[model samples]
Target: MYQMLVDLTKPKTIRGHVDVVERSDAGTVTSKGKKKKRSRKKNGRTSSGVGSDEKLNQGVDESVDGCTIGKLFVSNRVIAMGSNGTIVFEGTYDGCRVAVKRLVKAVAFEVNLNLRISDNHPNIVRLYGTESDQNFWYLALERCTCSLNDLIQRPTVSEDQAKEVKVPKVMLWTDKGYPSTILVELMRDVVSGLVHLHGLGMFNQDLKPQNVLIFKEGPLRAKLSDLGISKRLVEDKSSLGDHATGKFSIPIPIQIVYCFNPIAQYLISLAVTGCGSSGWQAPLLNELQMRAVDMFSLGCVLFYCMTGGGHPLGDRLECDNNIVKQSKVDLFVVEHIPEAVDLLSCLFNTVAELRPKASEVLNHPLFWDSDTRLWFLHDVSDRLKLEERKANSDILKALESVSSLAFGTKWNRKMGRAFLKHIGKYRQYNYDSVHDLVRVVRNQLNHYSELPLEIQKILGPGNEGFDGYFRSRYPKLLMEVYKVMHQFCREEERLNKYFKGSVV
Candidate 1:
């Protein structure tokens, strides 16, 4: 329901001709034809930045296309600006649509460059190349639909406005938008990207919804885009042995240090910008380790997505930084799932040390179900080949999606309660009897479509509507159920053949 005012058909307002400068092959900023000294600022703002002198015009070729120079044809269409005064322009390079991020100050160029180089994941923005002017640095990246914050914060369309359009659930907002399934997928994408980043030796000091971009393609995919305020971890000498292949280990050990690298220190001191908004920023930001800070921000994001775009720390978070530190996340939704509440509890824990690591979170049962466990595989092991790792992760994700669709969490809970009713009656059965019972249940489920009317009548009543709804979706549901039961049969067969009465 969030509407962004992006008119691709409408002519964009082009700013007038501006001088284009190039960067040296060594990556040094140069102005026109001379070596220019880059001015450093605590906040990323330079006096002579790009588009500083000109107003919006219809015709003005900046002529930013050269070798070590710019190669993008920047259009007048303006994307959202960053909190730090960075302007993103919709541009093109070699006929490929791209987003060009223009920064006033080149102070964080090296920092941004390092972070971009280290980042290479599907759920993170892809940086193609970079260009610079006398007072600005432009980063060419893959263009996305909009930032997560923009999408969530957009004004919901009035009922009158949407009277003609048939908006799908994926496109819905207000009281009927962004269900748990979509939220889980978004969370997984973001977490997967963060895990990849954390695997590298860097931490995103600025992890907020504004920094998370949304690609509105087949299904909504979210990507972590900005890393200007990120900090790279300086490896400790003692941890060398843990780096088996000399590659940085994931969930890397980091400690709270008083002094950060020059770039990160500069980012931390900014009053109005850098890092993240107060509510999303972790308490004792500088005192806790980098991962802890990121986890806190992730927690905030999770809270936002789960509650239909509400902030965890409340709207008053902007009034004082102390409020974020003291505020508790109270998930008050009456029908909220306990698993989601448990996840939030871990994220909002006051003690930073007690927070769960990114890897631990991906393996959370909330992300897996019986249907998911059959079709896909979870990658709990990091000791596999690159291709193998990716394969397993993709498979797991596919399985997870199948689970979300076929036996979504809501139905799973309902069915679980219904099954629990027979537990008391079956409690007296032995292991062998229990096995037979499971087989009989599987057989009945397999032929659910063919059950007699009288037999169906005795099956119970609390979920008659639910049962009918699922039966309507019978083919798809039954296919998934059969696939799951097939896996169970295979496992049982293997166990019976090898370990049937034998002690391991």
Candidate 2:
């Protein structure tokens, strides 16, 4: 959807003439005239800070065709541009299409980080090789179709326009925007990438829609790109560790190296003065620990995707102000998807410590199918039946809070007296307590098929019948129940059991 406005004719030359170098096995670049030894300290400092244990290789092996600098080519067509004037151009390497990023008068910090972790997962953009001339540094990376920003911000096509555009089948688009299933899958891809990065002791400090790239080669895949402002957590173990554990009283100062480009200068300013881009930044950006910052930004990104480019905390100009004041989010857009609303509430919670981890997010009920969600609801009802006596427990307290807030109240009335009377013969139904609410839902789901034809039509049919009805009528009931149940279950085991074949 991103407009490629640059002229296709007269492809601009990157460099008229230059000596091509090949990286030999000795950690040095050899040209036709001379051999230059690449500085290990410089490359290491570019990513991991001065004297850090994470060492970066000068270049990848020349044996791989993709890594050979001589086989790379750059065109004039621009793919995208950074805030600091870094230009990404459509290019090729070893006869394979790639994206060539040109940085003027600046070091390639992003490239250093990408080379270190690119091969670890499919959700991360790959780095083919790096090349430099007198004026600019070039990084060849995996080419993606477009960014998440472009995809979500695409204007809704009219009926006639829709007929003309040959959209991919995997992208399920409708007048109301993408379906919940497709949005969940895209968010899962992103969260998986975040989990991988967090496991490696890294934080993508700037995580907005623009940085999330979408690959449409097979199934639609979302990959995390643009690590220009990302931070390595192991750099200052004591400072960052203390911050992570809530020991630091003030925001830690970010270290900045001098760079000539305006883009790098702008990035340095953000690093030294703030967390990330304004609208997508976390509320407690200065105080929250490493991954929490990313999770909050991810919450904003998720909201953007689900709402067809609407921000939860108002528009771009007002978002930062709203976040600073802890203003109530405008969640009406996703009120129809209770599970999504619940997950977003946690991710957007004002208390940074309460936000779910990346791995836990993937395990949320939002990613579960209709059948899995129904099963989960049934399981929660069974557990609540046993634990109802432990009123002081956290799970019960959560349920009580949800009940007091009027979530799923008088459920039998909503089902009509006839439907209630039919199930009333089996057992007594009281909708006053949270336990009763769960029981009512569980009983209704259990006797779905046996219900009268009129009631069956009201509840719909097949697997999603009850779920669709309940989610539309009482948007918070099932999700609140899920939160209560999630607290009681072991996350690792639950994930292995329920999400075995699912999208997490």
Candidate No. with top TM-score: 2
Q: Which ten contiguous residues of candidate 2 have the minimum total lDDT?
A: 49-58
What are the runs in model 2 whose C-alpha is more than 4 Å off? 1-69, 156-179, 235-275, 283-288, 323-336, 350-354, 384-408, 416-428, 431-461, 486-504
Cα lDDT tens digits, model 2, 381-474, are 7766656677477777777777744364566656666666776788876666676767766877888867789888877787676776665556
Candidate 1 to truth, TM: 0.56
Clashes of 1: 1
- What value of lDDT does candidate 2 attain over all alpha carbons? 0.61
> Candidate 1 residues 1-504, lDDT tens each?
112222211122223222221111112222332322222121234323223122211122333222222344454446557755787775544334456777776454554555455546888776665656677777766766555665554436554332222222354222322234565777778887787777776677678887887775578778887787765665721111124222222222221221434223323433323455555666643244567768878877876766657776667524234333356767775123444565667866787767776766665434443334222211111111232446455433333445544444434243343343443343432222212222333433444456555444444332333233333332134334333333333245322222121111
Clashing pairs in 2: 84-263
lDDT of 1: 0.49
Best by lDDT: 2
